[model samples]
Target chain A: MSSFVERRLSSPVKVAWLVALTWVGCVYALGLVHQPDVAGDASGGFWALVIALWVVATLSVAGLAGLKLRSKPGRLAVDLLTPFLFGAFLFFLWEVIVVGFGVPPALMPPPSAIWERILVSTDLLWADFRQTFLKGVLAGYAIGCLSGFAVAILADRVPFLRRGLLPVGNFVAALPIIGIAPIMVMWFGFDWQSKAAVVVVMTFFPMLVNVVAGLEEASRMERDLMRSYAAGYWETLIKLRLPAALPFVFNALKINSTLALIGAIVAEFFGTPIVGMGFRISAEAARLGLDMVWAVIAMAAVAGSAFYGLVALVERAATFWHPSIRK
Target chain B: MSTTSIPLVGAARPGLLGKLWRGNVGPVLVVVAAIMVVWYVAAVAMNWQGVSERFARMGQDASAGAVFWQTMAEDRPMLPVPHQILVELHKTVLDVAPTSRRSLVYHATETISATLVGFLMGSALGVLLAVGIVHLRTLQKSLMPWVISSQTVPILAIAPIIVVVLGSIGLRGLIPKAIISAYLCFFPVTIGMVKGLEAPDRMQRDLMRTYSASTAEIFWKLRLPASLPYLFASLKVAIAISLVGAIVAELPTGAQAGLGARLLAGSYYGQTIQIWSALVVAAACAALLVVAVGLLEKAVMKAMGGRP
Candidate 1:
């Protein structure tokens, strides 16, 4: 055991491990008494066993972290893994405490309950995925981005509009979506269309602002060259302004991708025909189906993250020239 | 593409209204006036139920006098005429009892409290998290991605969960709403402050290092001061976002005293007049908060040696 410890950990790490082990032993000796409700479960002994393993895991973390700190070349591993370990630790503690104490699902469901629900509710999950991800978010995002891009172009072409519109755009951009979402619901009624309308409003101004800033990129020399070449407005735009604006436009697109999902989801919560991720999450929570609620939330998170990640990848590809994406 | 154009004006001297309305004031007023005029006309002509509907079909146009009369008509559903809304506002703010639910001031105070509490908590936590992340590379990676991603989780979805869970545990009232508000507001502050704190070029950092400045000194004396502009800008945004969060939190859980609950109650009962009045109050609340931020920003900037 000592050799194994030496191979894996530095002196400081070994000391920390020894300390943690001693604490774990003390905790074990102090007792494995459970709550009156949970002390009778078949898995009480199993849980106490898991609790002991948690100690071992905690010690391993301290040992690894210390080893990483003392090394000259391995700090990068520590740097990346520490937060991951912390997050995992948080999840572990949550699971253990919630289960060990036999907390009610209605109040706070265990992670295992959430996982099990996710495994079972494939159909309801699919329906929500279709309503939110496929129809509402995608449609709203496309229309919002395109409209913002077109308006930005017009704003750019007309000097008066650029001066006149950008500040107003800024004001409009600051308008909160909650203020607008219900209004959209009132206007469009309770359907995916209303939800899509909310998404559009949420996304439009941000994209417009980004695209406008982006078009300001070309240098004086570049514009002068274009002028000397006698390029038309569209010619100059297609060749130069639009390309320069790609990074900013992509920035807006990435932002709006998430915004669109959020808008659609939130819109559904206000009033819907009993479908969509937001609706399901709301309805399930109301019913005290905590596991199902988590299942829907997990689905929404995955969908939202995937959408954002895809936009980011596209941005990386398109803006390879941008200083922000260094080699 | 042209780097420079002839300046909008030859010199800095403003021509009266140009000075008062110069930065953003004129444009905001102009837009408000235009919106009001359109709303008044649509109220009469379309007989719209409320502003929301009028806004949906708002692109249609009419003459000024005709629009004016149409707005005054009792039949309008979508557009409440300017005069009518003013009367309603008068009743809510000036005429109604101070403690009445119908009074905008009382409701506004309640909403404001939630907004303030949430914004402070959010801004404070955001700053703390930013400081930690900047000092520790371990935090910057795993947490940064999660922080950004956390935002994508619709507050609507999470609010219900929070309210339900917290309510079950006998925790309700201002704190729950404030927690949600803080969640929304903190993201911008964190992201912005991180950028701001790391704003200095390598040369400037090296200069600081040359003086043998400690991390705390370097942060307090150099980085913190440098990050003020970014911090304030984000604060302005965060405050507005927090108000929205507070209001939304009200919606999911139907608090008795919030602007959100008023809107929800009005909508449920189909009280168009009440709904419009509450909306006006909310919009005014936002406007006031923004104006306050602008004032604070100007003061800070002025104190910071008046634009170099």
Candidate 2:
């Protein structure tokens, strides 16, 4: 029996099966025998079992991966399955712990409760999204990106401005620009406009620095070819420099997507009318509405991920010819 | 082609004056001078209403020069001039004792302390996570996507929740603020370290394997050293963000001390000069911290026998 067990462990497929079985057993223990009360009031033994099961499941998954799968599909399957299983397990643990332990709803609401709150407050969430993401973040991102690109072009034309502006750009980048949210609110008043202004300020410097760096990406040989073709500054820039800069420009876009969202939200915290994600979070948290706050967080996470994913997808398409993507 | 036939521009021997004019300092000074001029003009425009209102209340017909001067040097203007902020900084830093609440130095220390604590916690966690992720494919697969997705959720939106939750759990003040700072800081470090750890080419890693080096041996000799440059670059970013985190964390808590509080207090009383001074001090602190990190990187690289 010992030899049989050792032989099975030596095979990656058998090890994967063992991991699955262990996971099933852990889930059974968590769900059936040691299930705590609605208030999560459970004995110490029950909590101990939960912790032990977590450790076992974690180890099993790690063992399954460490043995190393030979087939590409097998590796891909393990990679895909691992995070999904881990994520599900974490959520399960969170739900069980919060529910079974009777943790204060005010301090830590269960995922189910937050989900219900999200369902009930769809309209409110939509309005806040419109206010923060649609109006403030998007508008600011467009303006900031355009101005950064334009200035980068201008700086490329003028060596003096390039030297002068790059340092200034670096200096501004180091400033905790999010701290300017309050001042921006004061300047532009307590509305989405103020938040948008803050987003612009937060995002502008990053884009400028990135585009300036990106503009230098074209190789000397490429520029020489342009020069040989008798290309003017505008022609060389448009045909060679700009294309080479796309990867860096997209990097800035990806970065600024998060920055813009953060700026708008933080700006809302200082002062805002009834609607916006930041305003909602601060307001709900103040009222001890932890569930509502979580709901808003879920919204922000989805929106942010979608925004970032969109930018990345665009980058992939735009930079397909680049060696980094070609592989 | 017209361009192909054009004469090549040769390097010219420049006089001292020409060299000075073409240098970085000259351009930077010109830009700073331009900004100063613009700021002074904007200050006058923004403060004109308050100046005029005060003059009217006094029932005095002021000359244009008096208006200009008063606008530039108001007791509490809507937008304080640069000199006004300078005066406030001098008074706050020099006139009062550092321990005083009213002094900017006290608040700066409080914030900086939190920032440092948070940065240490964050960097330690980041390096550990990177090490784990690099060794364990399971973690790399599971943790990396989540790590990438995590930053999308703005910490500012969640800062209050963290503060209130932790506050209720009987943890308060510095720990909560530091946690927020760590949250902001850890992402950059993790990303950088991951890239850095994986930086060693396949041949280099295979060399370690050929020598039958232990995992720890490989990590210590190859991976860690290779990751230093990326680690330091990210460390600078992390430190700056940590400061921002400490400041933002102060905002939601209604904390009595910190740079964020100074800005808040200034805003409450419409003390524009106070706000501007705090901002300037924060910027200066960020600059100093970045320089400090750069120096540390030099020392670390030198010790590692890498290029400084």
Tell me the lDDT of model 1 at A288: 81
Which ranges in model 1 have alpha carbons more than 4 Å from their true place?
A: A1-83, B1-4, B7-76, B297-308
> Which 10 consecutive residues of model 2 chain B have the lowest summed lDDT?
B1-10
Clashes per candidate (backbone, < 3 Å): 10, 4
Report the lDDT of model 2 for residue B201: 99
Candidate 1 is scored at a TM of 0.83
Q: Candidate 1 on A1-327: residue-level lDDT in tens?
A: 423543566665464555466447535522442445553242656567666766665555545444535465657765555456656656656666676666787988777679988888899899989988898888888888889888889878865466667887877777655555665666688878888887887888999899889998887778778989999878999998889889888889878877787788777766888789888877887778888888888887788778878888988888888888975
lDDT of 2: 0.85
Q: Residue A327 deviation, candidate 2, in Å?
A: 1.2
Fraction of native contacts (fnat) of each candidate: 0.29, 0.60
Per-model TM-score versus the true fold: 0.83, 0.92
